[model samples]
Target chain A: MKKIINKPEDYLKEMLEGIYIAHSDQVTCVNNDLQCYVTKTKKEGKVGIATGGGSGHLPLFLGYVGDGMLDGCSVGDVFQSPSADQMLAITKEIDSGAGVLYIYGNYNGDIFNFDMASEMADFEEGIRVETVLGADDVASAGPSEPGEKSTRRGVAGIFFVYKCAGAAADQMLDLDNVKRIAQKAADNVRTMGVALTPCIVPRVGKAGFSIGEDEMEIGMGIHGESGIRRGKIEPADQIVDEMLTQIIEDLPYNKNDEVAVLVNGLGATPLDEQYIVVRRINQKLETAGITAVKYYVGEYATALEMAGFSISLLKLDDELKELIKHPVNTPFFKQ
Target chain B: MKKIINKPEDYLKEMLEGIYIAHSDQVTCVNNDLQCYVTKTKKEGKVGIATGGGSGHLPLFLGYVGDGMLDGCSVGDVFQSPSADQMLAITKEIDSGAGVLYIYGNYNGDIFNFDMASEMADFEEGIRVETVLGADDVASAGPSEPGEKSTRRGVAGIFFVYKCAGAAADQMLDLDNVKRIAQKAADNVRTMGVALTPCIVPRVGKAGFSIGEDEMEIGMGIHGESGIRRGKIEPADQIVDEMLTQIIEDLPYNKNDEVAVLVNGLGATPLDEQYIVVRRINQKLETAGITAVKYYVGEYATALEMAGFSISLLKLDDELKELIKHPVNTPFFKQ
Candidate 1:
């Protein structure tokens, strides 16, 4: 309720307008609609990668649209999915001679909308569009059933996917290679989160959920997707251990396996605390003989003003490593 | 109060450990103290730019240490000044024949500690460390006298000073020019914030202050410093108009003045809301015929999880413009 927003209904529209103004040099509003903001960094004969999702998660979908990153982003209302029309418009806007790739979090709404966009782009406009779904949230679905992997929601690990895919695209890779790299990035990533408090949806003027003072929801998805376990909040070490254990084991990262670690905040958590969690994660990785080659810590993806954090591990190979290391100059995911 | 910290007492120590671990490639802890993280990006005979302050402000003190940016930074406990020892050690470590420049926000603790470090660095290490105190927070103090400008507290606008000063330092400007540019940046900048909710200090486990559900404090400082006025929380446009009016007029910014605007989140406010604030800010400037040459939004400086934002305008010149657009890469800040 204590938000600096205008009309709740205009939240998405106004937010994108602001972003376009702030980053006008790097991006432009596509189709005169605020939902789709395409980057001015797009190059001819390069694969155009796009990602979009609900609003409120700053730097999530829109933050990656820039140099060495996504080409366009279709935004939705806070925690809601963008319309297929918006996505299709962005696909057309970003598509060069090369094809377009849709990379996004694994959510029902996003899947439906992006799928529709893909079909419409291909059938209606004869544009080639491929999809790479991200379902890295380990707690949303278990690894015990491989078939259910797609049921998992995406979290902070999507950033890893975006980086690799974006970098690959930036390297002027072919469309097939870009999709392959994106899928590999998606498959190699895993994430788990803890929510200290629920975020209030601006329109709702109330939190999506409530918790006791000392309680936290472990493995909560970005949009308050039901977490697996809720219990009394523990210390930083305990929380990091519990969350990272699942993420590492779920990915089955083993000895001598190199990876990138991202300790991301879920809105209100301070970067200092995220770094604390990353410190523990690095120690844990060292003890396990799993080398964490690169580390990113901060609010990469958020759930409104929720006070929690997520640990994402991307099992890395030389290709993924090189791709991630490629300089990215986006407003959010800068290298 | 909810937070993702292990122990309030260990917050600073743990946070620094995390930072060292996260950015080990680009930075290193100086003198075995986690508080003083110096960048590996320092070049021989280049004026070192060092800034530091309380721990809670993300990317304020520590985040700017990287290539083409700050050469060193010393961090303090949450909302507390770092010890003079930490500052002195960094001054020594980053000094590469060229003198060092100390650019930091104007807080009492920071001023006292940094001044001590400056004196010690001069006496013990024979290093030249000129100071440019950032007192751009327009609301913290009034212009009581001609020389009372130093009485104002620095807020998010300090980032502009850092970017410009760091860029100048990276250009290998001599100590005097670097200091002059830093002072120019400080003098040209002004910031005013509105606070919706106060943040809780970890040790205290309580908010610094409280506000009614429907109330907001305009001109509030990042650390809950008393603002100019309190009133019912208004619409986004209303708040932006009120805050921007004071900031623009205080600077007495003219119709033809070209400026850079930063609509920064205090901590917990969503990016969408910050954008909304920025949109209004940009519009207001345009309406006044003042050109906002550039815009920077997001949480440049935060007060823990305080739900508010500040608007900062830096009267820009050709020198400042070129310096700001200079390429710099750091973990938290990049352009």
Candidate 2:
């Protein structure tokens, strides 16, 4: 694959520099390495918000770091989690005097690294560090399987936790309260994605997976993991219904429960199709008697040009609703 | 190609319904048949902001209509312009006592229909209507052929105008002032795009154009128009330089000129690649003695699943800088 870069290894560093330059007023380089871009605001008594995971997903980890959102975000190589040291550095920089809260997706590498970093911060720096892992992809593991919780991966639904955690932090909520809000958002949320085509990793110069022109993989992970099922490409409305039904069944949300629906285009799905899917999904929600208090349709969390989308539903209450509705100024998602 | 719609004709209408549901508190459906979505806020005595175009590009027209941006947006069939009647109705609904300002990208169909609607609004309703067409794609047409100015096609650079115009309107600038600012933004702007692969229009169910794996088309329009040059897919850095050279030369921004750079992903380019391109572009600007006051990198305006990107630069002065820095609360762009 032809890519524009001085060296493949230096790609991430150069990209981070560009992000900091564009958002200089709002963001700054955390360390000399330039992997982490952090917000300039510092609150002595507020909980510090830290989120990080992979590089290709922009406006997610990087674009989300600003006022009313993340305090710091550490970016790794494409689709790869940052090392424990990198996470530790970012946590240390943003700790302020108050406790630091690590809100990240529930991917294995990220979980392990963040956990290690939190422990390191607690022991070495005497900073209180708490974490909330987002595991909202219902398709990653089935209910029938035991000891499969570890296998359940985090996808785009992680944004729900970010919003909740960010709002809590902005309001100067304690670490425990922030953790609770983040966990509540994560637990109430469920997502399932389908991939019409595979994404090519620039370094690899090949597709992460293979799919025929007429087929699609349902419940595919953002990083191109094998999906739960594969079949011929079906109508968009049917595909949306199937994805929504799986999520609804997994969560089994009550009829009166209010929810925030996020119909996210993975990367390559056109806004045309995303809106079409959202229409059917809204119909499904109405039929089930669920009140969609808040709905977001866009490429909130995306795979690199993976022609597909995911439906993430976060069952909302007074607190979650307020948090999600809180005004955020990010490069990608702004309210 | 499989899609998620029940009926092809109902796609746009259903999609508009979904958008309203997502942002119900902020936007409402003006006309179900026309797929017209209008913002709830009606600023009295302010130049009513309005924009509309095709449907596949999200956040462009629909996501952009909100508190500080557009008052209404008329979504067309995928990659097509709205009818004159649709534009007229939206213009009528959003028109406050002051007047309605039509801010649109320059496309043959859109310009013609919007012109017709403006005439009707003037003759029928006596509502003063002024238009500022976004003609930022410098690569669309070469130096003026005898008796003709360059036919600059509108691409992603339209977002810059939206920001400036919205800010002007939000500040209650008169229609003439708003039009002047928007036009200045449009005139100062220049963009160049290249497509690695053609997009697949949902309505058409086929690729918009053909390209081999190692091929690319430079100066391609948003809707898969034939480019000025077709060549082998070059490195990302080279592609960025090529695009930047054309924009820089066409606009001829000087050393003392402050500018806002928008390195927009045309849907399918990964964030990593976008950052890589931005890094190089920033260096080029610095080397040219140009000061980049603001920069944006994301899928702001897109050609559905077209694996490409465009660079937009607007020479900024005091007024332009203030407008660019103004806070906007649109669903897609928040500052």
Candidate 3:
């Protein structure tokens, strides 16, 4: 594997050490534990927003912890879930009278660990915690029926959930209110992706899967989860049209509805290619009478050095519109 | 070729179209031409900062055009310089009576065109214009002796020049003062890079250079330029040590000197790998007693999808420290 890394075992640890050294003024680890990180911008009586998932996806779980965003995050290995103790430590550290809200992707291992951490925090520390799973990948599951939580896998659209929920928490919203907002964002956002190449897990030292280079896997998850279809690669506009069609139809975003577009690069895709996809999306959305009110085209989420791209659309109301525009400061993200 | 693009000839046009659609609120083209883009956040009396180069590197030439940064930019095809006329158009559009300052990479084609633009702007439009070429790549040439400017190709270190010069302009410094700060940034910063893979230009439709599966080219230029050495890829820390050694010796940064670090990814390099490099740089600088005052890591400049990374250090004084910390807003960069 042609990767810029040391021993596979030290990958996550060294990455965290580098991050801590670089951004000590804004972020700090919990009790010197590299697995648990919390923002230094904590405010008393403000609801804490915490997120966690596997490593490799920088700016996703840990990068969100900062001013006007997540308060804490527990980190995992390459694609493995963090321990419950790590999550509990973060929860306890971030909670200050106002309860904590857990915002993470809808993955089985992550859910189990976060749920266990939630229970331990309540039973052992008397700290209240709420949960909101980001399930916005339209390919993994169909759109939720009315009054039903989605069963989809979360991908890049989780950024919108962290953004809106974090803004709500920063506004001093109560735990229930913040959870409600997080859930609303989760419900509104939809994502679809196409992978041109598979990424290698450091420990594995080889790509989990492979395509014929000139081929692509449509709807692949960040962790190399099985996608819906694999076929020869197509042009940028055609690929974007396919992804956008799924995203719009999944939410059934109606005429005159507005959205925040995130054309995220999955690791190795160039930013220029992402903007090319955005060009097609703008044309398609304009034709559909859906106005994309804001555009965020870059790598917000990724899968190691996988060569691919994902398009996420967050349908917006006045509340979400304002929340997404709220100021935020983080190591990876700034607005 | 595995790329998300339409016809090869249309690549630049479509990319510009997408950028205009996404960032219309912050940027606009002069005379409705995609070749000349200017920031919308223009002020009447503030000195204008203009930069230009090829189109492949996002956030390098064009992405810096926004509030508190570049006032305008001229864009060319991939890895090619924009024409003199396009540069002149950008100069005319952004010059708000104070003056326009040109800050771009040090390259033969770019220098020729920008100098022509400078002459045209002065003789035809009576607009005062000054130029500062970024010659910060320590790998390209040896360090400059006292009273001499180094002859080196510019790489990602241009970002530091933009950050300092743009802030100086935003503070309402006149043309000469802004040019001085730009030149100082160019003089103080040094960069070195290593590439594991070569990128395929869309028009070329193939890699410009190739290496063995387990090898890397040290000190390669962004556009497949020959490097000082090629060998089996080493561990991340070892590679970083070699790079940092050259950068330290070039600047000869002394004990207790402060610097701003930029561990930039060249397109296909993962962010995680960049941080791993940063980890080593942090350790080395600590040992040397140099304080890395700030860190800006990610893809600030890139070579299409070349898998590599560059380290840029801007030796900082109190003035540069304050200027680097100055708040700015752009599509790709923010502080």
Candidate 4:
């Protein structure tokens, strides 16, 4: 593969090392540690927020750790789960007398590891751990009442879950209050993405799936899951229309409900394309009478060199609105 | 081209529309205009800051417009310059009776267009425009006396010049004061980059130059200027060591001088790789007895889908340090 890397196996280690050196002000490796990293300047006395998952998704787990963001993150290898030890260690490092909140996307390995870590923390130390799983991918499961809470693959909508929960934590809300807001953010959020090109994993030189130059897959997962539909490439407006149509109808978003829209580029897609998608999303929301009062269009979450984008809508109430609008400063996210 | 775009030629227009829609809270189009976009949330009574150049490099021109950044940006087509008319119009719009400070990368087309705009503004509108040309790319020209203020391509170091100047303007500094600080930032900064792969321009749909799968070019320009050397792709630390060796000696960055380090990804390179490079950079700086106080590693400046990274260092004095540390919030940059 034509990558700017020395070795495929060393990719994860090198990446974490880079994050440590590059963002020393916002984060630090736990005791020169790469597996677990915590925010250097976290808000004190708040319910410490933590999130983590497999590597390769830049800024997802580790990037959101600073002022008004996560307190710590436990990172795994590419597409592999971090050990329970790693998670427990980071959890202990970030716990500030007020318990810890582990908010992550609902993936099998992640669920197992985080659960194990929480149990380990409870047994080894008397630290309380509250969990809020991200299950916002609309294509992962059929929507039942209150929306399918389980088995739904969490995707880019984790951005909202982390942000709202982190904001609440920044405000020194208790563990219960932070968990409540985080769950609300998850329930109110829905996301779907389309991929124009396949991403090449560093270890594997070939793509997971072959895609034609003139086609795209709608509802593509960050892990490059076979999407719901594949068809010829469409204009920005058409793509946004189809994706938003599904997301809006799935939630049955009310005519005048408020939302914060995230147009996230999956790695190699340019910011220009993201904005075009956002422009169309704005028009669609207007037509649907949904007030998109806040918009974040950029590379919030990314798959390695994947050429596509995911549009995530977090239907907002007044509390979520205040949390979303709260000032945040981190290496990857600043608002 | 395997891009999620409607037409290659329409990229710039669509991007501006996206930015206008996404950042409505911070910026507005020049009355439904794509060529000129101005900040809606600029600090009044401050010297209005403006920067513009060719499109393709996101967040450089338009993304840096808001409360603590540029007041306006005159956009161009992909890899092409914006017209003098656009610059003059934005210059007029961002003028807050404190005159306008024009800060941009030192590219030929940008220099010509901005010079023409300033001339037109003087003759036609009687607006005083002071410009701080960004010439921080060390490889662009030989380092002569007084730091070769002219004949250097701006590259990523322009981020600091705009940032410090914008911060000074936010402090309500007069036009001359802002210009002075911006110039200081430009002179104190230097950058060098290497490209592992070439960028595919949308208009062309083909790369300008191609490197061997295992080969890399050191000191390559953002526009793909040929570098000082090319060889097998080495490990991240080795590459950073060589790059910093050149940069440190160029300015002869003293033992105790404070500076800011920016590791900029040229579009398609992964953040993980960028961090690995930063790790080596920190090691080298410490060995050289230089103090790196602030670190920014991400895609601050990017070429279209190019897999490479640039390292920029800004030698900071007390005034420049204060300006850089000043709080500023924009759609793309917050510090």
Candidate 5:
């Protein structure tokens, strides 16, 4: 593998160690456990926002823990779910007596562990815990009906859910209110992705999957799961159009709808390429009469060094628009 | 080649189109020239800081143009210097009678063009333009004497110079003071990098260079220029240690010297690997009794999709410490 890591077993631990060393002023581990990281900003009576998932996707679960965002995160190995104990530990650390909300992706292992953690937190510490699973990857599962509860694999669109929910929590919203906002964000956002290359988990020491020299995969999962279509590489505009079409149709964003567009690079995709994709998205949206009010183009979520990009759109209302604009300062994300 | 682009010849234009579309609120093209981009925040009395370089490195030259940072940038094609006319246009757009400063990398083509632009601006518009070229890659040239003017190639360490200079300019420092701070930053910072793989320029449609699958080139330039050493890839710690050792000795940093550390990804290098490298740098600095007061770890300067990372250290004094902390809100950079 071309990865700049040491022993395969040391990947996650060393990364956590580095994160703590670099951001100690803003974040800390719960009871010195690296797997349970929490923000140092403790505002009493504010509803706690907690998230967790597999590693590899930086700035997603862990990188979002800081001012105006998540309060804590349970970290796991690359593409592997964190243990329930780790999640529970994070819950105990972030809870400030206003209850804690669990926000994470809709992966089977993560769903299982986060649910268990919620149960354990309630049983062991009498902490009220709620959950909101991000299921915004429209390619994973199409919405059968409008406003349906999707089983879609969560991807880059989870960031919007975190932003809305975190802002509500920071404003000292009640648990039910915060959960409502989180659910709203979960319902409104949709994402679709294309991959040009595969990334290897350090332990695996080889690419998880392979693509031909001139090929790309549409709707590929972050962990190299089977995509909906695998074919020869298309132009950036064409690729973006295909992805955005799926996302727009999935949400069926109406004419005159306002959106916050996120053009996310998987890992190795350059910012230049992401912007090119953004240009196409903007054109498509304009043609569809959907207005893009905000643009976030960069690597927000990634799969190791995989080369590709994802397009996520969050259809916004007045409440969601105001909440999304709320300021945030985190180790990886800031506004 | 595996790239998500349309026409290779249209790469730079398309990328710029996307950038303008995404960040039009903060930046604008001067006189309808896409190659000349300037910030929209006009402060009449503040010193205008302008920078430019090749197009591939995002969040570097053009990305720095915004509030509290660069006021303008002259954009070039991939790995090529922008035209002198472009520089003059940017200088004219940003200058508000307080004068403008040209801050860019110490590349021959850039130096030649920016110098010409400065002369043209002074000759035509009576706008004073001072220049500070970032020459901080210690691996490119060794310091024969202490505090010597390096002829080294500019690399990721240029971001520190931009931060320091931009902050100084934003604080309404006179042209001389801003230029002095920029020079101070340019002199004190040092960087070294390693590349695991080569990147292909779009128009070229082939890898710029090649290395063995298991080998890495230490101190490789951002543009794939030859480095000081080539060998089998080592652990992240070892690579970081080697790079840090050279940076420390080049400046001959002493015990208790405070510094701001920047672990920058070139392109394909993942945040996980960069953090692993950061962990080593932290440990090494601690062992050497150097205090690290700030950390900026991410892709600040990149070479398209090259697989590598660079380590930069700005030996910070109180003045630089305060200036670096000054607020900045650019499209790609925010603090």
Candidate 6:
């Protein structure tokens, strides 16, 4: 694994400095550390939006922070959640008079740490905090059956939640409203991903998992969690159908129900393959009598260079539609 | 080499259908073929913006088209430029009474085909066409010497040109002014890239190039062009030094000059490594006494899972700064 770095230890610091230099106008590093980039403008009445997660997913946490998206982002080490202290500091820094909203993915460490930070903000800092955890990946646990609690895992679909929440904030919605809208978006969303290969974490120095050249793991987690099933690499149409079937069945979207569809390539899948998946997914949606109101087919969220994709569907209504359509200005997503 | 596709040939069409469904409110596929997604409400007086390149590089061309960025994008095969006829159809369909501006990366096929389409548009449809070729990869081509032509290649730095040009178009600038702003943005930019590993095109189903696990290629092209030199993967600081030294010397930006910087991950490099690269790049910029006015670090333009990264600099002026800062609403870039 040849890489460009002074020492593996210095990787995080160097990267933060570069991000700050690039987005200096819209953001600045807090405490001169690359852990957080807070927006420059502090609107008195706007709810401060803060997002955080692992490092590899760019334009998700950092790039999405700007005028119309996240107010700040707490970046952790690769695939690790930021410390509660770090999230606390960022929350304080970006907090306006109104309140602060925490939008993050539903990972174990993230949930635990962010919850602690939220409590600290309320009791110690006198700041109100609201959170909306994005748990769109359907393969995280399983269906919510009698014994299955459906352990929620956050994946690329968090980007959509950020967009919607940011739009709500941009519209001067309060923290409660923002959290509600974000949660609504999250609840209506379900995603399932497949992986052809595993990614090598810089620290790990080897692939997180192993997949044979002829096989793929379906419902793989971004952090390389064991997926629901493994099978031979099949045609794109079959692969997409399997992924979308799980998502559609889980969400139980019905005829005339509008939805936003996202077919995301997990880093390594060529756009050509992703597009092919999207085409098949579209045909499936039409056949199922579902109306895809909005569709995004690209690498919105990725798992390093894992050569596969995921399908995300966000069931939409009038309000969700308006929120999804709301204007946003961020480095990664704009609409 | 596992992949998900029933037929490689139908990849583009399927992906375009999915994209159109997701963004139907803001974009739609022209001719029902999903080759081009034109804006739904292009103002009649504004210069129509059209961008297209290969498929894998997401948000680069497709995600950038919306309310304020591009009018439409004609997606080609992965890493391959769209055909001349496709370009011509996109130009013709997206024309909003005003002239159309074709903005794209400076690849050989893209240049030739887009040029042909522009000529056809002018001669056949009288839809006065102009073009701005993004040539920001400083390592690929040097500045033109006295009477000598530059072979500059466009890479991730094209995003800056897109923002600036899109802003100009949003302001309803005429075709000439739009072209001038775009060219100015392009002229002020420079980039250099290094690859840790080569990418594999889906159609080809092989690595674009071969590199040892312990080696890296410096000054590599987006499409795997031979780099200036290859060497063992060095430390992040040293790599940044090498990349920035050449770029700074080539552009010779003054101490007082302000610029926008982009530390772009070429597909496979994780965010951890990207941030490490960004850190060293910023430190070097500060050491050189250059003021980085703005910075973006992420996978803006990519080469399908190529394990590499690039650095881009756009020396900023008041006009360029304003344009860069202008509000942009697209699926990929919002600010």
In terms of TM-score, which candidate is stronger, 1 or 2? 1
Q: What DockQ does every candidate get?
A: 0.78, 0.61, 0.81, 0.61, 0.85, 0.52
Which residue pairs overlap in candidate 5's backbone? none
Indicate the residue-level lDDT of B226 in model 2. 80
lDDT per residue for candidate 2 within A14-127, as digits (tens), equals 778777777777778765768866778777888898999997766577777777888888878989999899889899889878889888887888888999999999999999
Q: Report the C-alpha displacement of residue A130, candidate 1, in angstroms.
A: 1.8
lDDT of 2 at A10: 76
* Index of the highest-DockQ prediction: 5
lDDT of 4 by residue, A187-220 (tens): 8999999998887887886788899978999998
Number of colliding residue pairs in model 6: 25
- The complex in candidate 6 yields a DockQ of 0.52
- Candidate 1 segments exceeding 4 Å error: A142-149
lDDT of 1 by residue, A1-335 (tens): 77888888888778888888888887888868878888887589999998999888988888988899899999888888999999999999999979899999888898999999999999999899999998898897754555544678888898999999999988899999999999999999998999998988888888888889989999888888889999998889989999888877786656899999888878878777788887788888899999988888777888888889998889999999899899887766678
The list of candidate 2 runs beyond 4 A from truth reads: A2-6, A142-149, B2-4, B145-149
Error of 5 at B291 (Å): 0.5
Better of 1 and 6 by lDDT: 1
- Cand. 4 Cα-lDDT: 0.85
In candidate 4, stretches whose alpha carbon ends up further than 4 angstroms from where it belongs are A41-45, A142-149, A204-206, B42-44, B142-149
Q: What would the per-residue lDDT of candidate 6 be over residues B1-335, giving only the tens digit for each residue?
A: 46666656666666666566555667777777576667787687789989888787765778788777788788788777888888889899888778999888888888889999999999999999988888888777755687564588888888888889989999999989999999999888888999888876667877877888799888999889988999888887788898899888877577878888888877767665676776677777788888777667666887767878889888899999888878766655556
In terms of lDDT, which candidate is stronger, 2 or 3? 3
TM-score of chain B of 1: 0.97
Comparing 2 with 3 on TM-score, the higher-scoring candidate is 3
Per-residue C-alpha lDDT of model 2 across residues B37-93, encoded as one tens digit per residue: 788888888889788888877767777888777898887888889988888888899
Regions of model 3 farther than 4 Å from truth:
A142-150, B142-150
Error of 6 at A322 (Å): 3.6
> What C-alpha lDDT do the candidate models reach, one value each?
0.87, 0.82, 0.91, 0.85, 0.91, 0.80
RMSD of 6: 3.7
